[model samples]
Target chain A: MRARLLRFGPDALGKAGVVGSGRLYAAVAAGGFRRYATYRAATLAGVFTNTVFGVILAYTYIALWDERPHLGGYDQSQALTYVWLGQALLTTMCVMGTGFEEELIERIRTGDIAIDLYRPADLQLWWLAQDLGRALFQLLGRGLIPFVLGAWLFDLSLPASPLTWLAFLVAVALGVLVSYSFRFLVALAAFWLMDGAGITQMAWLAGVFCSGMVLPLNVFPGVLGEVVRALPWAALIQAPADVLMGEADLLGTFAFQAGWAVALLGAGRLLQVVATRRVVVQGG
Target chain B: MDSHSHSHSQVDGSFDESHDSFSNNSFNESFIELDGVEKVFDVRKKTGFMRSERREVRAVDSISFRVARGEMVGYIGPNGAGKSTTIKMLTGILTPSGGRLRVAGIDPSRERTRLARRIGVVFGQRTTLWWDLPLIDSYKLMHRMYRIPDARYRENLDRCVELLELADLLDVPVRQLSLGQRMRGDIAAALLHDPEVLYLDEPTIGLDVISKARVREFLRDLNAERGTTVLLTTHDLQDIEQLCSRVMVIDHGRLMYDGPLTGLHEVGDSERTLVVDLERELPPVEVPSARVVRVEGPRQWLAFPASESAAPLVARIAAEYPLVDLSVREPDIEAVIAKMLHSMRDTPKPPPEQAERSGRAAS
Candidate 1:
């Protein structure tokens, strides 16, 4: 990026830099990172809450897994690991919180989205970059510490190989993509509905149950298990945890996550086009 | 004559970038052209708790005008007069429902992102700066977001900082800055990319006298030196008086008057207030062709036609009453627009003498 600064001319600042530009998105992502990093108090509070929840959920899972050994094809250690992973990922996936969608919805309500549209960048890509940065920061600031604490205190299944860790990281990234795309679509609903608070609540409810955050989708009964596992929300926590536990085929889980990410992102782009076509920014 | 004819041709003809030099040929091409552009919003009203009625509100009704390159024009209107709607359509935030609208040979809605590269907008009511970050951080984000050259970005930032007097406020977070300071910061952010045209919506709305003067002076220099086309929407007539050569007035989503500032006063039948301080409290000043609107202790305000000279009224008042001191105040643009809209509402078509007065004033 600094190399481009040396070649100073009008050509260096041309429209070509805006189309499929890596540096532009990276800079926006960094901006998002810096923006979230400013809320030191919020990060500390979030990390504390996640650690408390991890302890509570780990004990519950230990009790249940002990009653039924090898339940849902998982031993006691796997169930406990799933519980800790779910707690760690609660904020990173933004399943319960409104996340960036809260601010986006407010912007639409106040007609401040007009300023966002006045920028010389793709709207979807700009927000996607911001969400990716936010997810990464939350992962480090809120996700890692709680999981490390939980693993130290409890008997948990730890990944034995580096390759599995690498695959887990990739799955986690794709998980963020799927979740962001879904949230982006929900945020765009504010354009037509003029208020998306109700829709956001419904989305959060679905995410909590279907993402295997409260309990592993693997333990659900016949039809419910299959249905929850097939949902895009499952890609956020269940699939990533499964990859880390080395209980799922790497290629198969990735394909599922990648497919949902592409489909949801494509739908979001379409909705964005339609929504911006006749934008009715709420207030004058 | 050559400039006027060329501008006319540029508006009527297809998009042409041949006369793109902004400095040398200021009026040789039309930078912004609108032909009967309109915007209608479908607003729903809750007639009852479980029922509603959808109504189509025509916010911008077939407004058409052309702005030449390097021209600083004032767009003044009432709160709901569709001035903002027009500006939004021009910026591509709201798509026009009918007719053609072009800014620098590009349809704003069709090529919004492309056009965003060339135009800058400032809404005085809202600050675009990052609230949590320092003032300069927002500019850094824009620097990369717009892909501005490092040298040019630094040059423009330095120039804005120096000219806008933002040297001390650069490190302050936006949420902590006062309204006037944040406004100056926003103006600087808009200019960092060196856009060719700027749209300022009430840039002086909440500014103090000194800050307003600073902003107006900076804008004047920016226009004069860079030949940047500026479309200003302000309720303060002084902004138009000091900066713009022409003004357009909109009322009820229609263009009511488009001519020189003085012409608008004549056409709208606006009034000027004459404030006089008498030696003691009097009943009222008796004068023909003027009415006392307000009277306080030892002071009185009289309203007279703006087109009439204050000399005769002053002489008459001095001869009849004990006048200590006096000054005449010009009517504000809002009052002018309100009076214009009120008169137009009374008579669908303008009276002959009013038309003749406007015609003479236009010349």
Candidate 2:
């Protein structure tokens, strides 16, 4: 078996090499950057919207606190930090939407998926690697730059320690894995379902609302917040922001995120196997 | 297995001994084998939101053939006749539902990766190379994929470029090239790994005549020099006539005919149309096994069984009637195929009257 695997190594690499050479990752990155660069104009508009919402929410929080020491284990500074982190991470995560789903559906429709099926490499792994490459570019070129600029201009609370910064980087990697696995699992619905785009949209919307994109999950009602905290969607965005803001327990957060990553990765693989079997049975 | 191999060798030895005493004949070996292979597709038709309709489409019915090394075999069929499906099964792109298949001694469906290393495939309608990248970069990527040695890579690349005339187009993005140019590049890309078997599906579908000829010539040379086994599927009969010595005709998911091109022409009662021009206007020339199809102004077109010797008929015409111009046109492949398909539609009918009579007399 080991010998066979070693011999198969070059075949897998060849499959990956064909996909990688297309410069698709670079094009996707460039496209994201161009869209976001033009979206800087929208950022100017978001500035006003953020200021209005922040001031109104801050006032409402202060009035509710009645000068109390802390609310929900967060001091006023930390509470404000949550707001800023939520806004910034929302922009970052939202930049990597399920755009590849349409392409996947089209490929499946046209029987182009046969090419990937014939390759020696694992199809899901190949696509995940490409998506990872695209995510890295978007995180750097589209997400990080604009995020830093927004925070700097607005005087948001930044990470206080290098350890916090390091933790944030780890969290970001886990977050991307979780997000990509979820999106890929959704896209694999094309094997069984006719219109996977609708499913993707619903999943994206659910993730956006439940993962604290519009508002911090802590701001939700007691049961709702607890439910959101338990779901994997929170680990995609909220957990990363928690690390960056030094609000999460380091080891516990890492363990939780790792657990979600492993579970989702396994689920994605299982779904891939089932979907592939279904496709084969369908004679595609 | 060892005993089987020994017996096989012994059979070969005996055959060689018998032939070696007479003529110096070189025999090409079989690289692929398909024994009573069958592939059935379960085509499902979803009706309303709740219920579903299901049916089976036997894309490839029970059929068997072998491809010899260094031989180019043309697989021709009409649309939906399962040519692509058969190619897919042979290349390990699709698994067969039943029977045995082997390529290079490996079951392609079982050891696809190993099989892929020995075979190259080009589906003409699709571009396997990266559309956004320059064609050269795609080739380099493929080189890495197939792990071609640097020296071999350079040698193959140079040879392919020279053969396909792709030097000028290598640096251009695949999206920028014309269809013909892109197909040439695609063919070159598929051959970069120096695979033993090349499966070409509609390789010249959209190519101009010049490009098509260039492709055919390149393929001919490749087969000659490398002894590569080629299984080409094309709608263009010209491609078959020019490249393949053997042809397999499939229709309605079954092998209707599998042999030399001559087998199609020798359907027992082959007919030829002869157009004759007479010096003077007219007399009805009565000849057995010949019918006048059309007559206009000193000219008469006659249809006759080609089995009726053309020499005597021509002599009789020359001796009996004054002729200004005469021409005989062989039946076109298109017409032959059309007739074959028409016969296929009328499946329950006996053989044609002429063929039946000839068979009865022989019996």
Leading candidate by lDDT: 1
Native-referenced DockQ of model 1: 0.39
Give one digit per residue, the lDDT tens place, for model 2 in A1-284: 33333334443367665454334334434433443344455656655565555556555555655676566666666666666555445434542364455566666656667666654445665566556655555565445544554455444567768978888989878877777777777778878775666777788788878787656676677898899888888887778877877778888888888888888888877777566544544322
Give the 10-residue window scoring lowest on summed lDDT in candidate 1 chain B: B1-10
All models: lDDT? Answer: 0.84, 0.69
Q: Tell me the tens digit of each residue's lDDT in model 1 across B131-186.
A: 87788888988888777899999999999999999999999888899888999999
Compose the digit string of candidate 1's lDDT tens values, residues A1-284.
23212222233366775343567788778878777898999999988999888888888888887788888999999998998899888888998965889888888878888888888766788889988988999899889999999899998999879999999999999999999999999999998888888999999899999998888998889998989999999899999999999989999999999999999988987787777765654666
Q: Highest DockQ, which number? A: 1
The true-versus-predicted C-alpha distance at residue A55 of model 1, in Å, is 1.3
**Model 2, residue A75: what's the lDDT?**
66
Return the TM-score for each candidate structure: 0.88, 0.75
Q: List candidate 2 stretches off by more than 4 Å.
A: A1-96, A278-284, B1-28, B44-54, B268-335, B344-363
